[model samples]
Target: MNKGNEMAGPEKEILDGIATRSVYALGANAASTRYCFRVLRRFLGEGDVLELGPAEGLMTGLLQSTGRRITCVEGAEAFCLSLSARFPEVEVVQALFEEYRPDRQFGTIVMGHVLEHVEDPVAILKLAKGWLAPGGKLFAAVPNARSLHRQAGVIMGVLEAENALNDMDRRHGHRRVFDPESFRQAFLGAGLSIDFFGGYFLKPVSSGQIEANWSDAMLDAFMVLGERYPDIAGEIYVLASRPAP
Candidate 1:
């Protein structure tokens, strides 16, 4: 059995609490996967799309509906198998994104929370450049280690570290974290140009579904504040394009 697929005691406990206290939040975790896809559809008209690190295929279903040829590359065997079973029409490649490459070029490349975990972000971006056709876009998302929640948690002694959103000592720890400027530089060095980038969801992960009723108002306030001070947003979404000229 793949060890990563198995939930550890702490993770199981958290999931149990989430399921009991708020199924909506449990569901929202998967639902949030769609937000990036909406942004992708606007850019990718009618061509192939590449999705790296498609964990458990949460976003695969949404991409399938776009009518574009979708290729999902997953590192974990369990997730690849699950994704293949769910979307037979969609091509699922059971390989690490670092090793796998499609035969054809793509109009769009999508990845979420996959960058910081990789050993070499720049190398991966460079590799992805080959798969993109001219003017195609690469979309990526990751947690902001400098977010308000992380900062407050550090000061209040609620959390231990601020550099990485997740615990790195754990087997599943993220390898690196990025501020907007650093993140942009990584792509720039890879020959990709930034087309769009922004931070979002300026809230703590612990807040959960309890905020659902008032989240809109709360997020509005936080977003305004984050606009003035982006270090507070919990996560970021970025779009980089392969230069046409």
Candidate 2:
């Protein structure tokens, strides 16, 4: 993935740099979806996979190697074009997730940390639910608003001036932030049964670096400890099943 730094494009080059830096600075996002594969592999079998918001085909390409037919739907024209060029073996669809209509169903769908940016998570989940075959699984991850560090930071801010840039930034365009309960409720309303829900990391991140930032040592420490004690994780990953008849 570090090779992403060598890829070229004006905006994409910059974003790719950030993505690459994020990997080195924060223990590599490969860790982000590692558990998803760990959990999904048990139930996915030799089934089809659908991935939403595949910006640069990083994870899409990863899923393709599992020997399952993979469909990657992305709204960005440049990204979709680049993905098609880079991974000709995988099927890439160009469209917003909200508008995409698959001609077939899938046994497993993995959506990582994409809901908070959606205008209607429930609608999207329901759409995903419709795409799944009976007994299919939906794997979703989201940021946890009630993270331990966030609460502590709030209290600390009460005593003195805090950095304005450090605030929970909704302006750059995330529609909603979710706590565990609220997130679970949305999934349930979409007709998926929650199989598991837990946090993944517990480090403090200022808003500026929310996308990526950390010392290499701290990143390693967080990865080891968070896997051991997932309860204090700052983000949540849930594996939910479509209700069985």
lDDT of each: 0.67, 0.64
TM-score for predicted model 1 compared with the true structure: 0.77
For 54-151, candidate 1 gives per-residue lDDT tens digits of 76666777888878788887665556676778888888876556657578988888887778767789999999988988777898877677777677
Candidate 2 total steric clashes? 2
lDDT of 2: 0.64
- Per-prediction tally of clashes: 1, 2
121, model 1: CA deviation in Å? 0.6
Where does candidate 1 stray beyond 4 Å?
1-28, 165-172, 204-231
Candidate 1 has an lDDT of 0.67
- For candidate 2, lDDT tens digit of each residue in 49-105? 888766656567668778788888765566677778888777887666766778888
- After superposition, the stretches of candidate 2 with alpha carbons farther than 4 Å from their true spots are 1-43, 158-172, 206-218, 227-231
Q: What is the lDDT of residue 17 in candidate 1?
A: 39
| TM-score against truth, every candidate | 0.77, 0.75
- Report clash pairs, candidate 2: 201-233, 201-234
